[model samples]
Target chain A: MTDSPIVLVKPVLPALDKLGAALHEVLRSGVLTNDGSRVHAFEALLSARLGIADLAVCGSGTTAIQLACGALGLSGEVIVPAAAFPAVAQGVRRGSCTPVAVDAERTFLTLDPDAVAAAITPRTEGIVAVQTFGCPADVDALAAIARSAGIPLIFDAATCWGITYRDRPLLAYGDVSTLSLHAMKLTHSVEGGAVMSTVHPIADKVRRLRNFGIGAEGALPAGTNARMSELHAAVGAVVLGEADAEIVRRIQVREWYMDALRHTEWLRPVPFRPGAWPNVAAMAVRLRPDAPVDAPTLCDELKRDGVHARAYFTGRYRPRPIGTAGPTPVADELGKRIVCLPFWGGLTESDVMRVVDAIDRIGGGRCHESHALSLEYPG
Target chain B: MTDSPIVLVKPVLPALDKLGAALHEVLRSGVLTNDGSRVHAFEALLSARLGIADLAVCGSGTTAIQLACGALGLSGEVIVPAAAFPAVAQGVRRGSCTPVAVDAERTFLTLDPDAVAAAITPRTEGIVAVQTFGCPADVDALAAIARSAGIPLIFDAATCWGITYRDRPLLAYGDVSTLSLHAMKLTHSVEGGAVMSTVHPIADKVRRLRNFGIGAEGALPAGTNARMSELHAAVGAVVLGEADAEIVRRIQVREWYMDALRHTEWLRPVPFRPGAWPNVAAMAVRLRPDAPVDAPTLCDELKRDGVHARAYFTGRYRPRPIGTAGPTPVADELGKRIVCLPFWGGLTESDVMRVVDAIDRIGGGRCHESHALSLEYPG
Candidate 1:
């Protein structure tokens, strides 16, 4: 165990000069929130960066999803991936709709198109598909299913800011897409998110929805205050300007983890599709069925080794089935076995090696006995 | 008309040196959001300043209200003043509750306790009382009603940050109180709010609800990401530190308006109750029923004179009664006649005199003929 701790993720700060300049602009303008100039500038910058025509910056990713649902007039039951973050389900409920969980594909851990199609009933109002762990999902297939069912498809691309599918931005896939700029993500606005849509009216509706639904003429609909302040947007503009480079650096970090653990028999990294360009937002590994230590056990071992590993998305993503609905076996198994390793831009190659070595030793059965002995000790 | 525009409200920027120091701390720490250190520190500072033990900073005032309702388990019908901001009704709807509108008292332009008591039915769940334009409401009376009815009282003290009721903080009255730190408020966080509760468990529930309901053990219930970012909190901390002094300055500005307009024949200001300390968040005046011009006409005239006066809270607050409800005549008339004049820290005595002189001329029938001529002109 090393003395210094390795955290699961660290926010990538923007260049000091750029951030200072942005703050200076905000101070000079004297406008802070309520769709101020800085928010407009950030929205313009993000729209250009993501190659989307229209984008609405919001207070958070969850609020972005809720606004998208409201803009699209979604009601009744909405289908979401059971293997995603709890925010996905929470956003669904916040939009005045019910969330019906569906199974995820075993390979990519994204919502399975077949399962979504099967889950759709006459009561289903919309579909929310996630790009799990920055891995690009089968958006085309899911979009086709949604279109056939005459429901809006919302791509929960919270981790897909720097991701691409077939050389185009992954944000181009869904009818309405949401991107999270939380600190934990590959790119951030300190704390913000954006809702993008190809349709101008829907994006306009989202803008109104973020600002109390007050339109140019008058109050259009009922809305809440989900606006990003100039202070946050200033930070966002600076961080987003450097996002592409950070994404490239994170890819190198992901490769370091993959190469270091390729020969290990106990852990398997989630495979990214060949043509998809992933941002590597999180470095997650699943314990093999025959592994010596389970996910929680390995997480505890890593914590003791001065590493902050997480047994990620366990109970939140795999809730007990409602009524006669059967459990999603693949998502449940993935939830039980998956752990997120410490991966951030601040980590050096040596740091990755230390984490890899610790996991390898723990899985080899040598460190487990030492851990048991430490647990038995009085100190 | 002057070349420079006198705006209705301007956000006060914190001291540059302090803001720079705070930004330096955030850059050094690389902690952006998720209730990080700055947010915790700001919450502590505000709780200490407000003399409240429990407070949770959130994304916006509307979200703060929604989180309060969710924390207090408010459901069914919630009573609210129809003269308040539209965000009040929006927040209730977001919390899965129906808002039953009630009229306000003509004297203070706040929720009438008698009206509220008469409006309560067997299905009533809670009461939302607002401090209209920073004038302290009858909190003790409202609290007594809520307690007798066994329902929670949420004080929407969005503009009452520095207000006190009988020398105590206005926040001390309700079961849960929410404050707005929006840019337009007397003191702002750029884009943020806070939820405070007297009950410890309710405050704890609010903390959980603000962060997707993910508690220490697991996800407790469905929640949304309504967290205040560190950047916003940095601004908040600085602004809050100077809030007391700022409130004093705003009160002086309010007095300037009052003294300048004291001799006016066609305008009347809302009076504050004795023994109550008001923050004077806004400088609003109502046109007398026998005045020469209405509120909208006067606002337009002021706008043409390079003063951005607002006919505030029109359609959203004076919404059509849902179902069989009758019109709230008092609130509707107030909404039609009330106008907010230019008020901010930067406004000088001369600026107040200019606005007062313009209003005096406009109401005296001299400026009305000129405006009518201008309207008839093609260019």
Candidate 2:
């Protein structure tokens, strides 16, 4: 087989005809932003599909999380998982709160409710939990802890679009959940995000906060410009309309990788709970403790074969430990071992087999043998 | 005369063929954002046109200012003009700094060098000045004051895209300048902004700051997702290429309104200094102290005539006054009396005339009589 480069993610553009019609409609309306009709329509469509109420679309996922934190008036200390993206910590800091890092569970790689329960204090204002790698967090347990502590729970569900817990939308778990529609996600809007809230008043506050805090009465509050443009909304409306089909395709690709990698002793896939239905936003594998090669070495080997694999979340999320919580040893270990494989809707079964074959060759034995294999597989 | 509803601002969409072609390129490239090629191209094109050294495109004008402030490492109390948009103050606050409101010059309606000078203290970290309504501020004087104080100056040149001071770009006035390309601006992306700096280091920092502060080494700083999408950048590139022509067209529209309203006794246009080339981004009329109607009353009458006139500032920018500076009486008064009229490239000389005629009839006599005059112009 001829070696071909595989990217970790590729955005699936919506059908050209539908996208063109939406763009034309935007041009005709002559309203490019400020919660225009396209934004409203996209919001309505997403809310209906997600079986939620009061979905507010904004510029990007980070901003959605930031706005949700701001609307909830989060301050003092915010508890977050150490193994998440840097944007979660950045959002907490942006919302004028300090981040307290806690470890993720070893098996599922989601925020551990026990760690979160131990991290809370009198100064804790909120909890920002992550649905890591589209694996649903223990939202019920987290929510219970937050309620006992009288703090809000904000799910950094950036990669959890179309994901479900107990056969219901995973977004319905937290007080407010933020969804990312970035290009690398399973579904996207070029660059966009949405804040999903069950509370009407909180959603109303988010609506005002995203638009620079200008309410109907011309009064002001602390807000910034997080408004999503009509053009972006138009793209989102089209992509969201076809998200179900895209999810199905991604699931097939994911299953192919899982089946192919089942015989590999050194690589382990992060397991999800039985009742959870994840969008399969990414295909991440963990190197076993006794693996012959580390994640970085394996990634380098893949690179030599024209395959682009990445060591995911290596020192990008954890900053200096804050709050009274202790070090997150599990997250620290996983951060060095987790590697994200190239998985997307466009990948065929052959592509999956090729990737699996490359990994197998690289992990077969000593460094010199892997080097020879890489040379043989070069394009 | 038939009553025709006029909006305050209308975005001028690029030619259908060109815009469609640009969108197709975005789809083909499959790179939605994260400093894509289109964003780089747009920045280059805009920098060349504006004659600036370093230009960074971002999500919104507010984010541009916030990034500039962050790049400058601004903290403590920063001085700002009271009559400017709320985004200015919000940007300062978002940067973890405090905004000290100061008065504007009565005639120029831009930041007063004297007020800014008086507002400075040992704790003052920077100065944020505005080029109000495309009118040039006393850039040299303000720069001199900042230099003497050893502080950086940031110009909120949001509405001054095509504006020039003494035949030079208005952006050259400050240490860093921000431009808005919102749909309502003279030249726009669907939603975008740019930060221009003569100092390359500051500009580089801003570029990093806008993309979550992830440097090449993977080290993170305090940053959020302020990236402009490729589609928005493509729109910006096309709009910027034809900006000169758009500016020319808008100048004609501005001149027609100015000449038509020259005879009005109760309304006065904000004056621009000689040797300045203003972009005419907005058409604002100040109600003379002896005018028969207040700004709100006039806006109400105009609304009845199917014209949307709006009160300009209306207490949006001011926060609890800080520093040793006195109250901004001039900004306080102007905030109530200044009204922005409908203006855009789509408006014709006839539309200007109709607006002028409605204002004339409304201001000529008793307020109740104006209602009768508005009723005569039906849809």
Candidate 3:
């Protein structure tokens, strides 16, 4: 008999249900597009909820990043983390800039401050720090480096929707932050994103850029329809409403995994700073040398045993441009060794036990904190 | 007491319902994004329905135009119709080309071939012909000019969905034809569009371009995500399925308006051509000198009578970025006289008569084929 295969991720249902209810109102009201009433309401709600003082909702996170770059007049070169999603590089390129990949920190699996500082060039207009796996990146250090270098910092916070760092919303530190509410994220507006900045003037420029760089207020500048539809806005409002409870539930689920696998010999979880509270969007673990089996072998074994573990972020590395070829050593190593375990909103303690037991059986590890080699894996 | 104002246009219903039913499936499946199965299915159906061999869907018509230009490596100056949607000019600019406008024919409100040929400079890379108000443009002559100039012909068929010209699908004649499926169009995918091309290689490039220039077969080139979500595709599939019937219904309503207003004075309906069958996406009538009131005054009168009539495609003369602004006589004249009346699937024949009766009462003379006179009444 086949075991129930665990899913990698599923959208939080409260948010999804909220979207449906919100859309019913939209269908009844015929205001479908063009910065309508629903869109305005959603923007206000998102900005207030996320503490984004200067946010303009746009079409997608990619578009958001592109608009931010366009507003900054960023061109020629941009420093991006080697471990980030392809969209980070793509966004830079969209602004007619070159993506200069910086190495990532081995311990944190996020952008390394030292590597980013070293990658700066006279041609560098900015740095794009991507918040990978729903975790708060080291934006504070990156921001300082960018400030000293006289360059802007753009946070691709596509994964850090409900996260905070040092008692502040995660998106607040960067010069500009872009968020994706794509279906895979913790919150989704079907397919939508926004560009948030503390600076009002840049926010205004981004608004114009998103809408085809229209002339200005009262005069229609030549702009395209970068405006999100009411349907999408309605969905976003619903997602925003139930995000707090959903995040709490997700954090609780993440805690179980952290506790159960704290002492496993062959695995290490990603590191986060003490003051940072992550969304735990995806539960990722790295295979260590002390394990009985390597990552690939363990992954095969898990699949055969009906567990659906995926090599995390492999697709992001496979198809980079010629000059931007191959993954950085940290990402290359982790890309092969790391796996995102069965994750979602409703997985039971039994499901967690099943995953833990399977990991222990295949890799031969103790389930106690004292047995772990990596300090990052919390008890 | 104020009367309820008439809407300028209404979406054809059975068609809108068809779209709603498709959305119902999306609600059930929750497959919201990427080149999902529904998007793919819609692409296939559109290819068959439009009689285009290859078609690829994108986020919007402007994006499709940009993608087509990007895929074709189009650069330098391009000739465009002066009196068209501002988006066409914006699209050309986004594609990194200078748009050179040719005066349109007063009769067809389309690109005048001789004018297009005269305006073409040695730097001109192509011609962008637009199908205005659901009318098939003079594509054959434009194609000849493009051929002689060794440049491709692009058609902005944003309003020509379900339209036929010369016994062939209007979209099939150009090198690259783009269609808009915004909420305002005859058929809507809730902010969507597609690009159809005759050349397979270019079509393949366009597909990659829409997807951020990444190919599954090889390395990732620079690209953007102009992807249409499953929600959009689901709605598109349902609309495309019912497009024919919707077109027939619209034509019947259009005929009713034509018969009712055929003898009204000072209001001139666009004359029909033998081979041109428009989608009737919008109905416009120009105010003649003999009317009871001019276009603006008549429009206000209609509004007071609870019929909402709007000036179609009316904007002040905009100059290109250069030495001096080119003249816009057609746009200037049309801006003052033309108004769009209520049309769409949901509007009834009685609604059509109400508008006609309002116009006839204001513009006292009969709208006849020969010797139409303007009407005047003392206040």
Candidate 4:
């Protein structure tokens, strides 16, 4: 039997005994959530790792994005990347704001400053730039655009935790940044998230928002439950301790894919932003237009060959109001070309070889487009 | 010196060893969330125990309320009780609807059906009736009102689990019932919630809503992240096993409160609805208008005397449209008189006696008002 099909996302978990011991103590205290000590310790641990002084862990990435919007008091239209997960737009709406989708930049599939600037209007209250596929966005330019417009900039760095750009954590850029500690991510706390801020007192508001807006008096009526349970926090703490090393292992997995495809003419690895570190969350490659098989067909072939590959973010992208999107030509075009392969910290070199071989067997046509090369996979 | 101050809401937890064993199984699977097997098992366990065929565990009680709304596709004015926890109103708002606050019944401080009918408008989409302090609302009447108005009725049974009304589950009467498993509750799974429905396929919709509305294609725009983690489900399964018995202990503790207050004249126990069994979540009483110490002062004095008590629902409440209320006189007056004492499954007769002794020492005023004497303590 050809190797048991390598799954798309296999989580790298902490030692069972280690996480279990910490959880027993949580049960003994009779405080499972409502910002228990475990949650505090998990937050402190994440703060040290991300170097964020003001941060609050959230129930999920969508909740974190919504909390960030609540913290900033942004209730009008917010600018978001057109080429992002649907949760990003949903979170903006959850914060009682409409999302205006702007086209992503061609280089990194992240928010384009020019597109965001063009989409601004009197109703635009903020901007939520996404770190698409572990690729750093043009943060400085977007920040400048936000400053000129007198609006806040939030980064939905959901898929790019532990990644750095220009020697600084990529999430350290925007006014507020959110992380998704979903099970599929490189590092996770089992269905958890965090909202982080380096500018203003955003994190303080996020904390209040996470707890149903309850102050000393009572609930302020502008919040819902977004608290991460102590059980989640304990797992997070144990998993977080090994995140740096786990991320390094994921990086190694990405290189294995790079090595396997170096000589292939039909595909090239996505060019992440220069000086940006990779968490290997999105080990995607763009197919040559002239290749024998299309993205959907190739994905089918890979599945048949006992290899799992996905055309990530290829679902129906409907922004609310339907007319709020700026002409996202780059994002729209990239959707058809990019395909993500099974990549994780535990993925071996043989798995990468099997993936590349599946690609070689499927393609028969020989055509290459010059229009959207992004960057050539170096030989 | 004061028997550890008789604190309010000490959770009755499952044995550490039992919970830890289940949790370790979750760790071994490395599937922390996204509807893992553990979540499925926990939902099944809850469904069997509650005798509801359709149920879904949510991230928290607040999230459960919102998810139930999403499942029903409600988006306009929803009616809620004025004399209830702020989360009831907040959940309605989070569901993307403006809440119309109806006055609570004078007897049980639950939703008054007459007030609910008066508050309804052409824009009224649904009704959310709360089980205030484990006191069942007039479910049969509220259901009739909702049906005649062609709107759905939801029950927020956050504080009243395993309690019955007329030999039926208090939760079984509504279109959908939600529960809060917050740590302070008599039965808990740390920070968790559940949505239950018997009338329609509400649980199916809730499952989609909790999972970011992802179907075969991709995420629909109307969903946010509200999935409960496997870690939470593991703890819930164990804690749920003991909820029925623990609830019995809580009822016994409540009887001790009744016995201690038999001769008291300044306070009277809240008269719960007829044929309704108590979960003892709210061992609350209303102070006499002419009592020397009002609710707040009594609360303060109780604190000094090593007893903990709270003036439940005494905070500033602002319904979305300030004019949505239909003159909630009963609820407005009741807010000033109600007080919640220290309550839990393990409360002792001695602790109950200590609490009554503190109340006896604090109040010297003998004036009585006829407006809100729901019922008298038997002498």
Q: What's the TM-score of every candidate structure?
A: 0.93, 0.93, 0.81, 0.93
Scored by DockQ, the top model is 4
Residue B106, model 1: Cα distance from true site in angstroms:
2.2
Candidate 2 residues A1-379, lDDT tens each? 6656877788878778788788877876778888888888888988898888778888888888888888887768899888877788777776667788888888888889998998888989999998888888887799899999998999888988888889888877788998998878867788888888775346677777777776545434357788989998889888887788888998899889988888776787878767888647788899887677888778889888778887766754344333437878888788678999998888999888889888877776444343343334333
Docking quality tier of candidate 3? Answer: acceptable
Candidate 2: tens digits of C-alpha lDDT, residues B89-182: 7777667677788898988789989888888899999998988888878888999999999999898999988888888888767888899989
**Candidate 4 CAPRI level:** acceptable
* Residue runs of model 1 more than 4 Å from their true location after superposition: A216-222, A316-326, A366-379, B316-326, B366-379
lDDT (10s digit) by residue, model 3, range B1-379: 2245557765432334454556656766756777779888988988888878688888888777767777777767877777676677656655656678777777767878877777777888877888877777777788888899899889998878888888887777688888888777777777788889765346667677767665544325345677888877776676666677778888998989888877765677765445878647678787775555666677788888899886644543232332112555675676677777877766678888778777866665333324333232211
DockQ of every model listed?
0.46, 0.45, 0.28, 0.48
Which should have the higher lDDT, number 2 or number 4? 2
- Superposed on the true chain A, the predicted chain A of model 2 yields a TM-score of 0.92
Question: iRMS of each prediction in angstroms?
Answer: 3.3, 3.2, 4.4, 2.9
For candidate 4, write residues B185-299 as lDDT tens digits.
7666777888998888778888887877766556665677888888888888888888877888888988998888876777888888889886577789998776666776778
lDDT of candidate 3 over A331-372, digit per residue (tens):
666656777787766677778877877787665433334443
lDDT of 1 by residue, B1-379 (tens): 4579888988877777787777767777777788888888998998898888888888889988888888887768889887877788778777767788888888888898888888888888999889888777787788888989999989898988878878888776688889998878877888888899765456677778888877545554347888888778888888877777777788788889888877675687867777777646788788787677778778889888888998766764333333212457888788678888988877888888888877876765543443443222222
Which of the numbered candidates is closest to the native, going by highest lDDT? 2
Clashing pairs in 4: A290-A367, A292-A365, B292-B365
Error of 1 at A43 (Å): 1.7
- Could you tell me the lDDT of residue B5 within candidate 1? 84
TM-score of chain A considered alone, across all candidate predictions: 0.91, 0.92, 0.86, 0.92
